[model samples]
Target: MASPVLLCVGLSHREVPIAVREQVAVSADDLPEKLRRLKAIPGVREAFLVSTCNRLEIFSVADSRTVADDLLREVGPAGAPHAVVRSDDDALTHLFRVAASLDSMVVGEAQILGQIKDAHETAKLHGAAGAYFARLMAKAQSAAKRVRTETQIARGAVSVASVAVQLARKVLGNLAGRTVLLVGAGEMAQLAARELHQSSASELLVANRSSARAEEIAREVAGVAVNLAELPALLERADVVLCSTGAREPVVTHEMMVRALKARRYRPAFLIDLALPRNVEPSVNELENVYVYDMDDLERVAAGNRELREQEVARAEEIVREELAALRKADRERSAVPVLARLREHAHGVAKSEVERTLAQLAALDEKQKKAVQAMASAIVNKLLHGPTSRLREEQGGPLAEAAAELFGLAEGPGADPVANPVANPPEGEAADVLPISGRK
Candidate 1:
């Protein structure tokens, strides 16, 4: 029988919009049921689903190539139009790239590795994954680790929220005892608040027009919720200001910052304006100790970091290729195992049968003599088979194993007659000529 194919079928950011991706996306709570359903599909021997913000992929070991069609059908209506399919080596290579984060929306982001691990574990827990996925995941993780450690691909911040944090650190030295003022409770502001929270900021003040929204974000980041009316007071105390409000005009005006800067005795303050309409005034940057960064500035930093990461991608890809070659070689050697076992069993059986026949004819001999003859036959068989077995293993045993079975008249599996043909159990007078040690055909 042909070995099962490794198949990957999915819709990623490259092929579809977020709307289409969301339609097929599986949540963590729903993964078990999704995996169970996939395992039930015909020809799908083993499988796992990787669902994230950017992609929804199904990896499977399948009996037939048509399993790709089945997987697409299962991913809902969006799958057939946008899904890309890869089989065998290409599929495995794609998996390795995904685990290494090379295929992420923001390349070199580390989240995809953990996401893949979680998906694999979920599949295994639900019995949707078997030996094939276990090995594939292990190799993929190893390759990802190598790519991370051996290259500089994951060295910098690629997201706007993270870049804001980096810029804050660059200007403020360290956030250890610094207070951060979050000027909005919108999604962008919330993300910035979370990033600053993780940086060990001493205090985070959340200010928003809606008191309830401000309090909600404040509670999430372990901070105090201040009224938007207290912006001037909050600015004076804050070392960093992150503004992402929905106001039409500048919330942090030049005059407001000037008064706040004087009250604070001109201490350096880093301001990040993430709002689309510019929450902070452009002229506020003219203040000697005040640094203002708008969305354009953050995007520039992110773009620069992305370029640096792109430069490291070639090296990361080299590591992945090395790992892939090693895995393929290991798989080939593993495939030789059963064939080698069957070949040795057939040889040992032939040797034992011949020894038993000779011993019965020499019944006059002592027990010790009969035992020694049997030992001699076993020793000869081992010595004669050793060279062929060694060569078969070196050559990965595929074609050579089939040839060995045919040459020795040996069956493919156990419980078959060892001497099933004339070549192996030659008729009486022909026995001497069969497999002669001397070159006398």
Candidate 2:
């Protein structure tokens, strides 16, 4: 049977606008159903979906390369126009890069790896991922770990949250005594809260629809949890407001910010909107002394950070390439296994049959003499088979194995098994290990 092809199809921040991305974005509650639909496609053997704020991709192991077309269709018309497809090695490479955060808008950001792992676990839970995806996920995680450990790509303000904090500092001059309000308890909000805390912000207030989640995040940053109902009061007190809620409408309206600004006596208020569909209204930026930065603004700052880490980014890419090469080499060696097994089995059968016939003809010989003859025959068979066996292994069971099968008249097909019809009184000692083609030391 032909090997399954690796395929990746999706749209990312590089190709799709945030508005279109928002339209195609899959919520946590909807991911399982989406994955189920993808897995049901004809020729799709295994599949998983990765949906983040910046990208939505489907990774699959399928029987046909054209499965990309089906995957694009699954993405729907809005995303299909902006989608890109990668197959085989290119697909594998893209997955590794994503896990390593090399393909992120903020390259070398630390969140993509965890996001990918979560997506993979969700796929496996819903029966969408199989053996192929399990193995691929493991390799991608290993590559990400290596990049983090061996390179400096993750150093400094690499994440969008951290970059947003940096921008806040540049605008307000200092975060040291600033009261920062986090308007959500999501991963991005928690990250931004941590960044602000590390910058020595005097107080951190977490406001969320879920008080328990807000309290959880607040405790981690040595802050307080406030009720979302009191957002206007929290906004008035906060010098910097970071919002990353999942709400469809703008959570912080222009009117709310205007009132907060009047309450603060027109002091500069820095707002970072890290959510898709945007938590803060765009009109809020029109207000004087109020600076609002959204995902695109954060990305521009992140681009400068990427420029600063060009060397480390290059190193991370090298690690990804190394992992990809190693996986391909292992796969090649595994492909050669069946051919080598057949070659050894064929040779052992011929050696054993001839030895048995010769021994039967010399019936006058004693048991010890017969045993000695058997050992000699076995040793000769081992010596004769050694060169061919080594050559097959060296060639990773490629063309040499096929040629050897042809020469020895061995059966060749998906179901071919030379050992099914065993040779009676098989060769002993050194030749014993040689009988099983995979047993070579």
Candidate 3:
């Protein structure tokens, strides 16, 4: 679809805040609806969206270079700062890195591969992804698989939940006899529950606004379900708090925690706020004997995890670069394909017409004579095409190529313009950082 150019416009953990990222994130349940809207946008011939909590990425192909802005505009993430837009080769490279998990905040995480696959499948199911994206996604997945298979990129603390649990152990020394309170029942909270169970935390308490939802997660982790109203009491007794609620505002504020601490006589509590907008208040960290860890705090642990996996990262990068080079070379080589096909088709057509005419005029000829004439005609066609075919292919996208097409009338054929540039940068956007580089070429 479109120019066969790959374009990716996205805001990631690199620059965008959690607040803005959440606004554009498309979840698994919301993917199909979002994909339909993305396809309906003008200038976008093919499209798919990958919106994880950490990022909101739009991948598309279009005729004009300005499509990136149109894409972001269509997605309604306008005025969001630090969006990176790439086209063709760079865009593909970015995708490859993302699939390989090299672009993740926690560089060797394994969950991103599954997420990317889900996006690819969603696009295909909705008919938004065509031959180009299909092939590209497949190749990207293959490379990611290879990276994981050949390197140790996914060795430690692969998910945010796991990292949060690991850090809790460091602060508490041992989780075996500790009471771990989970303030929400989201995926992250469930994962934390599982981690706590594995760490042999003595008592686990799950508190949610919906008692049924809390009960469900509690059953899964063999923990007890407590009502949301019991949060203050649970907070007083709990040694560790993992909060991951979907609430828009802070659930555990400074004022609330101050009351909880008074009940505990100011005993130390370790808190991990995994919610995007943050469930725990930032000011709560100032409380004596209370330690607060947000996503950004967990990020520091992820940075350390990345450091430990540096060797694996290097290997993964090399593999990604290798795959990228092959893709680029293949793209460049395909430019000559259309012209060669047109040349062959034209020659075959002429040879068939002449052979039919000759056979009709020489009706007196025997069966053997007709066969012999057919063989000669085939040979003539082959000989006639050999020289010009070789020359035109070698002169792809130049004056000589244009001249050859005009001389042979192959210019009228659908495949004549075989070597058009797949990417172009439009000058409509003044923000060079956010605009696609295709327009610059």
Q: Pick the TM-score winner.
A: 2
Please identify model 3 stretches exceeding 4 Å from their true place: 1-4, 27-32, 74-79, 327-339, 350-377, 384-441
Q: Residues 1-441, candidate 2, lDDT per residue (tens digit)?
A: 443567788888887777788788888988888988998999888889999989998888887666777888888788887787766666778899999999998998889999999999999999999777887789889999999999998988788888888888888887899999998866886788788888889998989899998888788878899999999898899999988888999999999999999999999999998887789999999999999988777777788988999999999999999998777666546655766776667667777898899989999999999889888877887898889888888987545655776687664655343121111111234111211111212
CA RMSD per model (angstroms): 13.9, 9.6, 5.0
TM-score on alpha carbons, each prediction: 0.64, 0.82, 0.81
- Give candidate 3's total backbone clashes: 5
Models ranked on TM-score: 2, 3, 1
TM-score of 2: 0.82
Quick one: RMSD of model 3? Answer: 5.0
Tell me the deviation in Å of residue 328 in model 2: 1.1
- Mark the regions of model 2 whose C-alpha exceeds 4 Å error after superposition: 346-386, 398-441
Pairs in clash, predicted candidate 2? none
Model 2, CA-based lDDT: 0.81
What is candidate 1's lDDT per residue for 1-441, written digit by digit as tens? 433567788877667654465467676677888898899998888899998756888998887667777887877885556777776667788899999988776567777898899999989989998766787789899999998898888876755578788888899887888999998855556777788878999899999899998898889878899999989988999999988776667899999999999999998999998664568988899999899987556645666676776669988888898998787666545545656777788788889999888888898989899889989998998898899989988877445655776687654464232111111121245222211112222
Clashing pairs in 1: none
Which is superior by lDDT, 1 or 2? Answer: 2
